[model samples]
Target: MASRLAAALLAVPSAAAAELPAADLLIVGGEVHDGTGAAGRTADIAVRDDRIVYVGPDGERAVHAARILDASGLLVMPGFIDPHTHADGDLLSSDPDRRENPAYLHQGVTTVVIGNDGGGSPDIAEKAAGLENAGVGTNVGLMVGFGPVREEVLGETNRAPTADELARMQRRVARAICQGALGFSTGLHYAPQTFAETGEIVALTREAGKRGAIYDSHLRDESSYSTGLKASVAEAIAIGREAGAPVHIAHIKALGPDVWGSSGEIIDMVDEARARGQRVTADQYPWRASGTRISNALVPRWALDGGMPGLRARFDDPEAAARLRTEMAENLRRRGGAETLLITRGIGDADRWDGKTLAEVAAAMGSKPIEAAIAILRRSDARVASFNMDRSDIEAFAVQPWVMTGSDGSTGHPRKYATYPKAYRDLVTSGKLDLPTFVRRSSGLVADTLGLTNRGYLEADAFADIVIIDAERFVPRAGYANPEELSEGVVHLIVNGSLAIENGRPTGVHSGRVLLRQPSRGTCP
Candidate 1:
């Protein structure tokens, strides 16, 4: 290892290597993938404090180092940034297991974008302060959420916001951006956001645009439920065009049999929008199955109009109850039938139904599958891995230039623990995308999408968030049956220049920082 590292040191121009500041840690003799969809090169990177000071051929003479890692024969790249994750809730947990965030580390992730799907509070400063104060395993970035703001203003009411209420919501968004929120995020498919009209979203996103924040959203409808897949995408594009900020579609997918092969259509929509000078992009998970609640999968949007009270009231009315069952049955069929739904973590009596198919659970309960799903939803919010996406659609969307990779959630599915490595193995290695493109889509592209000026690359003066992987050995160990298992690939992981994982294991270090979105220096294209 020493001799191989010496070769890298000898490879640099002697003059360029002379007289540099001492580095806290030095990585030598690695295949450097700079995260720009470029070819890899043999290079060494020197880190001082939390920034990369040198990223040239020779490092031994370029900078003095207290600690030197002999990273020979490994692929050193910018640590991946997950665009959407549910891990933010775990950052403040008392349980060590959750705080450690082993799943993220194992998959070579050094940064996580949290408060996605409109779940984070609009009080972005307080949330960011709390996580930083508590200390996290990886870098955390907060996206001010629309759900909490709407819930606060409307209290789950299925109605458009009054003009005064709209002004309040706009003020909240502007305040969040000033407080260092990356952008605005909305899960319009979920209530009370579902209650929001298109004009309402356009108004809110316009506020985000004025503050130079991205508009991130979980598309309103991905199936045949309401606007349909194509129209939902158009809605997102319309928001971006009217708001005048870049729009990001969270977890872009052609979900359900009805929407399968719709990725091509989505691409065309984005392309046409781009032609019209609209900045539109998206992120996707590698899996064909998407994880969500049973209630969301079965219940019609109209049935959930007025929150729990309205839903229960409708159930009490015989006519409404009959209609609810009929619509829910159609919704179930649109999801490719109950047999396609796998109960990953069932709740209450449904706990016994975990790891079972909806078809099997329904048989066990001596009821029809749709009826069984409705019963489970009535009892508790059971989660499932719905295997409705087509492989062709997955590949079609993933291969797009505007698309990046993300793990929408971190439970009941292998994606949470294994999305990056799985994408590397299945997509890159399988020739769907080359290694450089894969790294670019996952890292630099994501950073660019979110306007992260100082991260997602192994560049000088950039934040020293890095990953070293033994490509031959890097593989995801997590599976459907064992979704929480740690992946095996990241032999060394560094968060903000501190070693967080070594030799394919965590080093018990919590050196993460709260990364905030930076305002652009000039007008953006």
Candidate 2:
């Protein structure tokens, strides 16, 4: 079958070698699932100068071309665009081949949005250039982080931003957008940012808006009964109103037993905002649990008042340490207890601690869960996954037409390899959702939400970021116990009209770009 498909692709037309040179590559004979909200069909795809030139039935005449790949008996579709990710530092470090990222590509993800949670390198342009120079395996783009910028300027202290500070932040945001940031992101749940008054964030969002950028955020809280969940959503709405930027809630979730069925309310709120002329959207991973830092679960906003130094000082002071522990104990109960948190990544001796329930770790240490939480925070900094989401809530949010699918995952979680596949296996193959609806949420909906042009559909003249997989054999190989395994059933992947992956394997190609936000274009920037 491979040989036949290769022969069929080789038969496509090409110009003379000396004059303009033959096209870079051609792919033919596969089931094409254009990222559009449409069904799959068999078609031929041609590439010239890294852009898709033709997409139709393979013709009869055999013509010359530079390279060709066969994708017969495969499920071909648009390479996935992960709207939420935190792979910026990973892409810049020594292991930039990003073996973890291929787990995404093998599952049909060709492009990813990094710099999420308001935590990205300060120099985004440099980081983008470095990734391109080092030959990245997947397309990478980013959003400037409001939290990090605040941390850099204010050192995690709680206070209102003076007028000068606000201006400085806005200028920084504009520079980042000009340097290649798709938008601005915030993590109001984390420090320094949590201390920020609503008006400051609104101001920053407006700066991004002027550049035609979007505003994405991990809201202040997702589980609390009082102002925690609602206030966070309101904050994002407010930012959108003031900034004139589209508001995108990061990893929209209804976590804990307390809020098991709160998805409807959240959706209604977003709808209300939209009714008021505010552009709001959200993304979610297909998982029953959410991951984050241990400190995030325990450390009080006041305890972490002075950045790392302040926290370290409090850890050493006996009286202050006791007070910190007491506050953490209350926070643990508020967050559904230590049993809800699981260690995912750790350093040194903590490596053996991964996958253990926080309760188990506390028991082994002969300490209370709150004490154990403090110990882990002091020892490993913040690197834990909290099992806080409700399964019904996950399913409810996923089916929303306006709610796009995203792997709110990192290299540490199986969702990095399994989010889309898991959705396909459980939702579509199991009959919970039709194939077209699933594809619409995963591809077209996300593309449309971000205003990405020319790649979501398989029509002529579109950038060919495509994927092909086997529906029957499709399954997520990664699990919570072994979170790094690659997925199965992805037979081929094409990015920007180039064969980036073939037969469930990476072709080691580096044909991606840093997409920035510009006043002229919506997302291709």
Candidate 3:
């Protein structure tokens, strides 16, 4: 094995080396999905210069290659694309290898969309160039963040922007898109961003539309009432309608028990938008609980107007405290109470409460779960997890023809490790989504939706981004209670015609590049 690896290394050029033959790599004896939602077939894929050269059974017999991989008993499909992620940390951090994304590769994710929930790098151009120079484990892309952009310009106030201010923000969005941001992403439920009116969103989103970019949003609400799921869907549709942009609701969900059956309505809205010729789509992760910050549990938008400091002062003030408690009662009811919330991460001692539910921690503190939630946020710095979402709602969205799968999360989250696998195991192998259609949503649909060419397909001219998994044994092992664990059954992952993962282990090769949306190609509508 060592000698073979050495020989392979000698054959491949260093990152700085000049050009080489395109069909230098070969993968044989694998069942290919073709990334077009087609049935699997036995075929050998040939690659050269990072692009697929040949994709057929008979043509590979006479083909000679520098490296050959035996993929017998494995399903070779397009690498999974995480449509939503918080990997900005991975993108900008000092480390250049991007080892932290192994959890994604374990589940066969070859590409990820960072800059989610309105938080990410301030300079998309610099970040993109840096990641390309540093090298990474998987393909990465940027979505200009509304939160950081707002914070950069407006600070922590929740008021309507002046016409001049709005115009400046619009220019920033346009500049970022031209600098290679896939689209504009917003977390309107969070502070600063949430404070902006709907018109503000529409105006800025139009900038992305002019560049033919998509508007992916976390929505203004996911809770039960008063800016809840229905209103959230309405906002996304209206943004698309008003701005003439393709809209994608990030991590689309109907949260809370009161809105348990509202998934159908959300679907209907997306369908209606598409039917009316307004481009709209959504992504979902296969999980029963959504993750967020603990501070988000009880703090009102007004109280959080100044970011962390303002919220802390309000928590510390007795007069403000009293009013916050009254609001807290409503928040508890809206969130189905603190028992449904969990502390995911925080300061030094926070990791101890990582998997414990809100009820458990609250009981330990001898206080109501809501109070415990506030206490933890205050002490640990405001990170918490909400045990929201229904299995039926997850399945309903997962099986939709227009809905594609997304992790909608990041490291140490169950979705990060098990989302793709669980979706395939539950929705596909369990007879919910037919094999072809399932693979299509997981691979092709996303590629087409994101305007990613030479990927999401096993075709003659596509990038050799493929995954070989044991379909029967492929299932997500990570859960809400046990997040951060690796999944089972993904045997190999190929990135850009190179092996990034082998036999379910990362090969430490960071060959993935930034995939920017190229509207000039006329691929994305």
- lDDT per residue for candidate 1 within 1-525, as digits (tens), equals 667556756776656555557899989889999999999999999999999999987678778677799888999999999999999757878766677788899989988999899887888778878778878888888898999888888888888889999999988887887777788999989878888889999998887797788999999999889889898999998898888889999999988888887777789889999888888889999987899988788887777877766776887799998998898888888889888899999878888988899999989989998778767767787889998899998899888999998988667889999999888988988988989998999899999988788899999999999999999888988888899888897889999989999887788888988887665444222
TM-score of each: 0.95, 0.90, 0.92
- Evaluate candidate 3 by giving its C-alpha RMSD to the native, one decimal: 5.1
Residues forming the 10-long window of minimal summed lDDT in candidate 2:
12-21
Off-target runs (Cα >4 Å) in candidate 2 are 1-24, 58-72, 316-323, 520-525
Off by over 4 Å in 3: 1-22, 519-525
Q: Sorted on TM-score, highest at the top, how do the candidates line up?
A: 1, 3, 2
Alpha-carbon lDDT of model 2: 0.75
Q: Write the per-residue lDDT of candidate 3 for residues 1-525, one digit (tens) a residue.
A: 346445544565554123433458777778888878778899988878778888887433435567677777788888888889877676566775553477788888889999988875558788888888878888998889898778777988878888888888887887788777888889988888889889999999888887788888988888753587898889889988899888888887878787888888888888888888887888988777787776666677788878888877888899998888788778777777767776666576666777677788878889987677677767665456676788888888887778888887665568767888888878777888887887788788888877777778888888888888898888888876688778888888888877877877778888889987665334323
Question: Which has the greatest lDDT?
Answer: 1
The worst-scoring run of ten residues by lDDT in candidate 3 lies at: 13-22
- Greater TM-score among 2 and 3 belongs to 3
Clash totals in order: 0, 11, 7
Ranking by lDDT: 1, 3, 2
